[model samples]
Target: MARIRIDLPEHFAFSTTITLLLSHINYGNHLDNAQLLGVVSEARLRFLKSMGYSELDVEGVGIIVADAALQYRSEAFHGETMKVEMSATEFHDFGCDLVWRMSEAGSGREVARGKTGIVFFDYRSRSKVTVPAGFRGHFA
Candidate 1:
């Protein structure tokens, strides 16, 4: 199995926490792979919403995931509170890559780490757009 690793810059910050339930578990008794993604997605939305923006809020200069990869280091069982941390590692003209690190809330040991590449898009114009100045400034 791959090891969980993340080295975030000091300027950027992103994080959220969530609890697992029986529904989040798979037949094998650990957190399901699909549900893991959903948990991270929820945290991402909540984090963005806290900043007064959302997936829909940035419609004109919104972003969509162009690629994503997740590496599981350990199983997260039901009822465990998992803390997910996200941050931008690379920012470019058209998009950025966000890294996610998940760990057990009690021990602080990472359980999984992942990254997603998001590309900006203008839904109304239906074309790729450059990263907005406001959004880019946050990572810098």
Candidate 2:
């Protein structure tokens, strides 16, 4: 598949500093792929909160990861500080794509870049839902 450039919203900005945890590393001693995703998940929550959104608010329209992609550039070892920068790229009728970048804190070495495609769903209806107006406007 062809790769699409992730264009972040003009005014969007959300970031959090994180230290590599022992539990985030694996036998090989760098940040594990799975653990990196967990870090992204944590940062996503924090970002939503900073934007005044809660899980309930998200759940109202139903957001779920439909697909994800990650590219690792450098190693992040234990005790090393890294920053996860996140922003909304674009919103579709039923979902949205989120763009993210991770890098070493002080060194500024890029660790990874990625995007997650989140789909909106209606739990009660058990079907895909349209993106809520409140959220769509926030990123628009």
Candidate 3:
């Protein structure tokens, strides 16, 4: 068996805080694995919104998550405020990886970290498209 490791960037370009709800907890009384990804998804939306874009419209194309990887570090309990930080990295012709980290808001205890590989797509044409220069420029 092997463990997944996520190497985070030194500085994140965007961040947001989300508080865990009872529904986010599982029978273990901590954050559920699946819910953690949900949290990340919310953070992703915030990151894009900050850049004045959305998953459905980045420049002229939409984005689809091609894959995802996560490394869990600690249990997160309900009512805990999580500080999620995100940055774009691993750029390619069509897209890039949105890397992020999640930690307890005040304690700074890392709960999880991961990256989602996103690919730009022309929904109407039903095909992948090259990354938008305008979108890439924000991170450059």
Candidate 4:
């Protein structure tokens, strides 16, 4: 099987630091693969909030993640602070790709690279919607 490859962007527009907790570790005593995604989700939320939006409400239209990919580069242990950086890219008519890079805080050692494809939607109509103008203007 071929693994997904993600090439990180040159610059990240936003970043947040999160500590890996004991619960984030697996039996192997390192950051679990599944929990890493949750950490990234938290970073995404912080990024959206900084822009005055949320996962369920971005400029009047909500968003749903259509796809996601992650490439883990190094192990993360409990009690370590990770710096998660995020950026928006690959814009389409109705959605965009959110890129992420995770590394050891202060050390700059890369831990992972990832991307999530998200599409705007109207919760009331239960249909996919176009990207909001305000959202694009602010983040694009």
Candidate 5:
């Protein structure tokens, strides 16, 4: 199988720092893959909040992550601060991809790069919805 390749945007619209916790480590003594995703989730939340939105409510429509792809580049240990940079890309009629990069805060060593496919959804109607013009305009 071919490895996943995600081309990230040149500029990140937002960034937030996060520290790895003891629970984030695995028996291998590095940040666990699953925990890294959790960190990404948090960073995504902060990014949206900064844009006046949330995963549960973006311009009156909620978002659902349809897919995720991550490439782990380096090990991250507990207690070290890392930065998660986030931006939006690949906008479609119904959705877009949220791209991200993670790096060590001080040294800027790349830790991971990822993208999550996010689709707008209407929970009350239980249906997928078109991307809102205002939402795209805000990010654009």
Candidate 6:
């Protein structure tokens, strides 16, 4: 199998902290692999909210996760606070990639790095839509 390597940007536009809960732990006593996405989802929401947007409304268009990839660096335990840093990149006509890195808050021990591909969507029309100009302008 090929290892996934994510080259993070020099700087992140947004960051938030989340403490792992007991529910986030798996049988092996670390952060559950599946729950990692949940953590990222929370960070993504915070990133958008800081810009006055939501998964259901980004400059008049909703966003759907088209794909996701993760590269785990280390295990995380409950009660550990994670600092999640995120940035938007890889823009296309209708979508972009939201890349992020997670690390232990104080120790700076990396936990994971990943990207989520998001495509603009129109819920009323139930169709894909073009990326909003205002949204793109924010990144520019």
Write down the RMSD of all candidates, one decimal each: 2.5, 2.5, 0.6, 1.0, 0.9, 0.7
For each of the candidates, give the backbone clash count.
Answer: 0, 0, 0, 0, 0, 0
> What would the TM-score be for candidate 6 when compared with the true structure?
0.98
The local distance difference test score of each candidate is: 0.80, 0.81, 0.96, 0.93, 0.93, 0.96
Q: Tell me how far the alpha carbon of residue 62 in candidate 2 is from the true structure, in angstroms, after superposition.
A: 2.8
Residues 1-140, model 1: lDDT tens digits: 77545554554377778999898999999999999888988877876676677875553477788887888889999999999888766888798887888899999877888887888888888888888777777666
Model 2 TM-score, all chains together: 0.87
The residue ranges of model 4 lying beyond 4 angstroms of the native Cα positions read none
Pairs of colliding residues, candidate 6:
none
lDDT: the better of candidates 2 and 5: 5
Q: What does the lDDT come to for candidate 5?
A: 0.93
Worst 10 residues of 3 by lDDT: 1-10
Compute each candidate's TM-score over C-alphas: 0.88, 0.87, 0.98, 0.96, 0.97, 0.98
Estimate candidate 2's alpha-carbon lDDT, on a 0 to 1 scale.
Answer: 0.81
> Model 6 over residues 3-120: C-alpha lDDT tens digits?
8889899999999999999999999999999999999999999999999999999988899999999999999999999999999999999999999999999999999999999999
Candidate 3 lDDT by residue in tens digits, 1-140 = 88898999999999999999999999999999999999999999999999999999999789999999999999999999999999999999999999999999999999999999999999999999999999999999
RMSD of 4: 1.0
Query: Model 4 clash pairs?
Result: none
Q: How many clashing pairs does model 6 include?
A: 0
- State candidate 4's TM-score: 0.96
Error of 5 at 47 (Å): 0.8
- Write model 2 residue lDDT over 5-117, tens digit each, in one string: 54444443778988999999999999999999998888888888887776446736556788988888888899999888988766777888778888998989989888888
lDDT for 25 in candidate 1 is 98
